[model samples]
Target: MKSYKKIAVVLTTLGVIGVSGCKKILDQSPKANVTPDVLASAGGVVGGITGVYSDLRNLWGTEGFLYYTNLGVDETLAGGGASNGGVAFATYKNYTNNVSDVYNALGGVFNIAYQDINTLNGVLQYGVAAFPDAPTRTAYLAQAKFLRALYYFHLVQTFGSVPLHTTFINTATLSDSRAPVADVYNQIIKDLTEASAELQNKPGENGSPFAGHAATKASALYLLSKAYLTRGWSSAAQSGDFQSALTTAQTLISTKATYGVDLYQNYADAYAPANDATNKEDLFAIEHSTDTKYGDFTPGASGGKINGWAYFFRPNYPTVNANYPASGGSGVMTRDIANGRPFFRVRPNYDYVNNVAFADRSNDYRYWNTFQTTWIANTANITTPRGSLTVGTDTAIWMPPYDPGADKRASFKGVIFLPPSVAAATTGANASTNTFFPALKKFDDPNRPSVNDPSSRPVVLFRFSEIYLIAAEAAYKLNDLTTAANMINVLRTRAAYRTTGMPANAVANMQITPAQVTLDFILDERTRELYGESLRWWDLTRTQSLIRRVKLYNAEAAPNIQDFMTLRPIPQTEINLVTQGPPIPQNPGF
Candidate 1:
């Protein structure tokens, strides 16, 4: 076991939380190591305890969240939208469910959450009594509980009733079984409520642009509302849960004191690469800096760029920043719906692409955010840049052979970081080769350092916009279609204009008729509003749309998709250490 040797001082209520409270405590001290003795000093304990959040940064791995968010959502499909068809996306679609048929990626939601619980338990076990200053130490406890709540939130959504391990268990006896969904939800509710109370007005770190700092009261309430909304709709929450959800969410939103935030007219500005937090629209994000994320953390083969390497990359297609003077990426959006239920029908008929009245552009104020012109190895296909985005040009492609861990071959990291071969593919005065595919325009940052700088940028984990979507969905679920439609307009109007191929009176006429506000409509609305973010799969599960959508939307690949896949199975490998009994049964239908 690794010894976390730097704990400075115990920063809790000045009393040692008995070890009996937890099955185990971290070995804060080691022979030759300056163990985190801080458990004794209030300040040192807080600092030492902060290590509990170490897993947050791991969410952006190649096989992790950086790509999963897009797969989970309906905003964009892996293959239909890109050339490689989002090769990494198979793990995300609904058809695969929990099974050994597929190899486990870095992000096993169950394992990750359990590990986090263990981390929190360690801090709570050693630091609560061990903190030097009880008040300061208590804040850490709140923060720890808050984090635990977030982890469980992700868990229950994905797996339904995950093995809710509250106390730290020794790996030797990690035989804990699954907890009922209700039990999991109850614990989550308890944790968030307490954390919000203690951390009241204590907003997360304004210093980091990313989600590094802790969440604020708004964050907690936002979560509370989502939890209630999910439960209220679930078979378990048939009673007054919906009303309770509304009240909790409303209370948090009502507090405009710290709730109000700036919204950037230019979407491209949101992902700029100044290696700093410059966007005013950001409510909360994990701030990354060069020092905080280096080597493997950088955006290269060795240090992949999961941070900037994100969802909705405009690949070098449809010509965003046609004047970008660099190699572009692939993955384009097609104008015609690729023959599917919602994908083909929802986009405005035609003439809406350039309509200034509804929605004009998807990028920022900079002209480059729109289109980048470049000659590539395969540049002959141009039917219409309208609905047809360049194949995988808009998606963020990385340097394939760069990272041995990922073992990607011939990958293009970014427009600016191309190697001699890839860069040579782009037509420069002396360059004869052409690297194809229009790169994604959304993740573009004019301030990026030559594409390889291990720089940190602020990334939103949760934002005010999500609040609006949640409200809209919740209202729709409560049978208030009018309210849902009204709220939905708030996001749509911002994304489009009257001229954007919509009914001339689109917004004015835009109403989710009570007849039209089915679970599907709400699902589509969620997709449009929160595309490319990691909320899709969870949203699908909560709404009971996973299996249906998976079979329908992914019919083309259904032959390869396993039908029994619904919930993920406990990684037999990870759970084999359990002394509880024979291996736990896999989630039903998985």
Candidate 2:
């Protein structure tokens, strides 16, 4: 409902201001009002597009979006320090259709998405006259359409059958109706198809005047492949949906060099903070920086614009002494920026951490690379119950991949946290208890201003490696096991350990044969490759595995997850605002 009011203000008062530097294209300020006549100029068009990019920060790295995409799934649980705001989503307890009953985060996404969709509509419609050059106009329009499709894709995947709005709304409108799921997918596919044709091969190609972080032809193709893949699993599925998805993904994979995107040689290198901006594996990313003007969060501001990715997945490492006392001293490993700020909104599921993704720990280096297994002492020399510990030389806390027996653990100088299974059995802690599991290392930002500050790192939304998984899944659905195995092997091979002492055939040990390809394998492979990237919920839902998977692997959500929960309830506020035409109906069973 707020979108209606916000849309009006943005269309009437939003202005065009110039900016410079690397991310200057997205650094525009909406300070002065631009009338309809002025909106036909080049500055106005670029500024409008920049506004659309700014809106992405609202969904990509924020807490609400993080919770919506990652929680209540098989891979995660609500952490010990999780706020009450996200409890309903994590536990599936008291989850109602009312926006106020659950936290406003879910509804906030709907509102923000629609607001941006409307703004993009205006940009596409009015900005046409802004560019007289053929290629320039087409590229601008392509960017807008690509973003519009992406917003709708999120809406459709989350809420299902969301109201399809293609035209700009300059005035308040009280009437809106949800379109059929098929029609919404049709529009998404159409927009992506056009965008794929018009967009540049790469972002800022050939020194062309394009936003450094703008969507490109590869981004469009990647999304288009996903659209077709998702449609293949829906009621709107056509005979060629799977084949089309496979074809499109293969095209992106085959022409990766042409699109200026490719998988990183090592999975660890792909997520290193140093490579955040220049990672070739990233097909599209939402940009954030240390500069307060361009980054989401202000330097010392409390909570306005910040990326919570660095904080949310973290465990309470600072309190490790309380749960598993350090042999040396309490201050052995205090909180630091290198260890990440532990907001503890969500933690990995025990099943996901120990038994599933990292089962092959020796052969797959991702197990060690993906998590911080050891905490080195940050304090000076101190003597305690067991031994003397020195800074940077001794281990303060060690969370081994597998449980070392009680005798083996006690022999170690520092505290040794057992595997989740052993720890749960010994301490009577459940999966949601957050008993100092290894923190996810992918989002850790050591360069943050302070231990408590949110990260300024750009969130990589889509990667070139995902295209292989998409193609593999589509291939499996189409009964092409050979292609599926081959596609998966590409990532699996890359994930193999290449350490000095590792086996020479580590990569070969990681490869799977055609007979090993299956739906479950693909899902598990996705977890191995893309966990905590905000795609698990959508992946399971697309495959109709959410209810089953949650019940099987997630103890917190098992009891309450129902078949009808796949589609989130349409926010009651939006339904209540419909004073004209027939009222919108909420999703069934909400």
Candidate 3:
């Protein structure tokens, strides 16, 4: 096995976070030795703590675990169409207990999590003593503790009863056992509560292009509140966890100005590529940059481009380099680098667009702001063999899955041939072959240095709107229906488009009453508000609604829905690597 000292040398050489113009938290000088004594210096402590954060970005950015967390939920489904056939990610869309694939797929999630936790453990043990001033030492320790808690939160949520490594045990040991779920949540709460007390309440310096990009009092508090809500629903939960969640959320709302966070008035502005720095809605986000040379935490990857989320959600159409007029028609469909290279990993469930989006709601800008239903061809020159000879007739590709009468092809006058239902628009004999589901255009990067590759859009980890939802849910759970309705109305009213009209987004007619504050209503509201935001699977799992929701919406995941499937199987490779003590057991079913 490789020595821990060797690993430390490599990590030190990598420097800390690659964010430019940020505070100098890393020591640039080459280190000959990285013992605990050497890390006792202030610079060393900063560098060590920054290294833990770098590990977090690497893990969250490219890790399959991040993708896995979004899979097989009610709101989203796998890419099962012809385009994404035979892909590795396509297989993971549905749940599987294949130990070997599970091991290989989540190696980064498991390994990097421990790597980050262990790094924080080192900083906690050695760095605290390194700082001479009490305030500085407390601040540094607070950041480390906050991050450690965040990482463990992900671990416990993904793989239940994960091994809790709180200290830096220099010597390798194989006897580590799985900590209880309640114990893991306890550690998370402890870390976040302690960190919130020490860290500044306001957002950090202009570290990246967005607010909430760094650890702060607000971020710690937000996560602590969420952790409490999660723990409150568990089998070994405490009595007042719900009350604690409600109180924390209430405190954040009342002190929003002190925290310098608020929901953006316009939903689209929150994700606009040009407005990241000005948007105050983001509570926590992973910062990426335009410079590829700064390097990435993930091994062998080199781009600051924001390709992962965009490409995964892009539409695979018009085969590469197929010019516009020849691809569809002049007025209908066209493809360009701006359209993105789609692998179709996560697509919207059929009903997500129809039943939820257009069922009765009107002027809900979220549907239009969050998704791309129309595609315009970038190129005009008909370079390839002009398959369908119609120029200037078809302009764009529109997949109105809800509109049964949408045209698949353009005729002489650009007339649409409407189908009777959504199934007719997407499937069977008359369905258009171009029936690629609506791509999540929120993360689309038109400013990427390279069009075909990834772009550097900051991944939002938490936003202020969620705090409202959290408060609402907590209040409802506590039987304070009035508070719950008021909390939810904030978002509902924000969603409204018209002051006085028949059909308006979240208008008075659309508002729910205190009696309507049910768990199902909250779930639906979350789905509408936070769709494709990487929080769905965990949300369902915590509520114990995974089986029911998946069965109701996803045909593919329903049959495989075993109760034990709620918790992921422990990767077998991890257990196999334990050469010294009792073996780690796999999750119940697998």
Candidate 4:
């Protein structure tokens, strides 16, 4: 809950700063006929193309807006913080101070996104300048356009009609008024259409990160299938377009015959470090390596510190943290408990896999083996770090006792237990808390505390699973049931699907079914599979199901939530920064 002003300090130390707002400035003049020497070099051009990906990260990672649009709108997500340290998270409980609130103005999301737009714009301008050949240049432009489509997709989903700027921003004609949502979608269609044509089976020779290397031409087609599905949802688009999305999705699925998208043998290996030997079955995923020899850990961390924000989820929750079960040490969960309550807790850096010992020892696969007190695996057993305490390995897991009829203490119980008030002094902030809400173990790069440390784990931004789901939803919406079902089954089989029918338990809770695989199912599947990946709120908002979905998920608490709580209040900082235009009007209820 640190201030945007402080946490994500935006000045790019990488000399890439001078070219933030406008893109064309970074590229040489087209009219000059200056006969640029670098135009012909593939290596230089390739490097510049890759720089676009880095720039994309740089733009979105600031201000946590990426999380705001996705997480803030959806009530399924609740900040674990003990109290309101800031505007958005605090108001999130009441559905107030949302990112789209114009008068109150939650400009954080918009600000960072604009920077992303500019960054993409610059990358394309430079990419086109460097690769002028028909095929090669088209491919790069397609990739640029594809990435631009991705950004715009998020934009349209979040704030409705946003300004569409194709040219670089420095032109005297600085800005365009908010374009119609249909116009924006049309532009997105144009980009993806061109990209699909240029990139189908284009192979790893080109440099677009996710859909470039290892991904076949079918990858682009599959993405187009999803894009078409998005178009299918809009009444604004002409007839048969939804069917087009469906057909594209089916066609791409048929390519599985030529180049299959199999699951990694072990369901757990999907979340392993990027370059793991077992890391096959990927169509495309965000590439991250712990940058040890280089300066930082993630794409941006530097100088042995967390200058840039790294996403965190509930340390104990399995759904968050890419279904790794016991990942992340995260922001704390708060429960008002002055009167009387009783619960135990943990901190963000550490994970508490299981407080209770499991009855069966045979079934300890991913979560238990990786980060829990695994009695299941004797080899993985953790003894006392310093020994001799009631709570066993004090840092690893804590099992503070409170029998069913035992006298209640001052702690309110929620999903993950919170510590009693008596232990509040211990659970404040310093990570000394032996009792409180359990910590999320996902983002902990223990030895590499500082961003400068080269060897830190990188989180997956997008992956093959997402591709599969996107294909499923897009195809399903287009009435292509077979392809949609197959796309979904790919993900299902990884978890535990049987030949004749899925196990009874497989359909138990949070499990996917043919019946549940509607737009809602697609959204929930995404939530279950890719929780912290930053797409939840956008998915909810896109379907206009946020209010109903959030109310259902959060009926136990915050039940009186209003329907209009969906759109966020735009940030005040942005309105202040703007030199022109009416103060951006917020969505009605904010």
TM-score of each: 0.66, 0.93, 0.85, 0.63
| Predicted structure 4, TM vs. truth | 0.63
Best by TM-score: 2
Per-residue lDDT of model 2, residues 429-483, tens digit only: 2122474677888988889888888788877888899999999999999999999
- Candidate 4 per-residue C-alpha lDDT over 456-565 given as tens digits, one digit per residue, 9 for 90 to 100: 33333445556677667766666666767677766655555333343455433323455546766666556445544456665666566767765544332245456665
Candidate 1 residue-wise lDDT, 1-590, digit = tens: 11122222222110112122234333343212113243444433343343434345556423245434445233333433322223334434443333332325423554445655665665666666664455556666776777788888876766566677665443345355667888888888888788767653534343211122345666677787788888776655746667667667557656745644534444444555542343444544554444422222453332233454332343322232222343453322221111101111011101111122123233212223332323232232432222222444533222221112222222322232232333354443111111232233333434434343322444567765566667767777677777666666565554433223434554444444556666776676564444445566677667777667655554333445443444444455555545456655656654
lDDT of 3 by residue, 1-590 (tens): 11243226223312323323346434453433345765666655666665655555554444354356666677766653322221222233434545344455566577667766776787788886776767667777887899899999988887889888787656556566788998999999999999888886655443321123666777888999999998998875899999999999988888888878887766677788887754578777766655443334222233222336766666555543333323453333454557776656667765544575334446455676667765554445433333432354443345554543324342222222222345454443122222356788888877765545565667778888999999998998899999999999888767755334636325675677999898878888887688888788889888888888878766656766777877776766677666666767888877
Better of 1 and 4 by lDDT: 1
Which candidate, 2 or 4, would have the higher TM-score against the true structure? 2
Best by lDDT: 2
RMSD of each: 11.8, 3.2, 4.8, 10.6
Ranking by TM-score: 2, 3, 1, 4
Which segments of model 1 are wrong by more than 4 Å? 1-44, 47-49, 66-69, 79-102, 106-111, 130-135, 200-212, 260-283, 292-296, 302-440, 452-455, 497-516, 558-564
Q: Which ten residues in a row have the lowest lDDT in candidate 2?
A: 11-20
Please, what is the whole-model Cα lDDT of each candidate in the order they appear?
0.47, 0.78, 0.65, 0.43
Q: Which candidate would rank higher by TM-score, 1 or 2? A: 2
| Ten contiguous residues minimizing lDDT sum, candidate 3 | 410-419
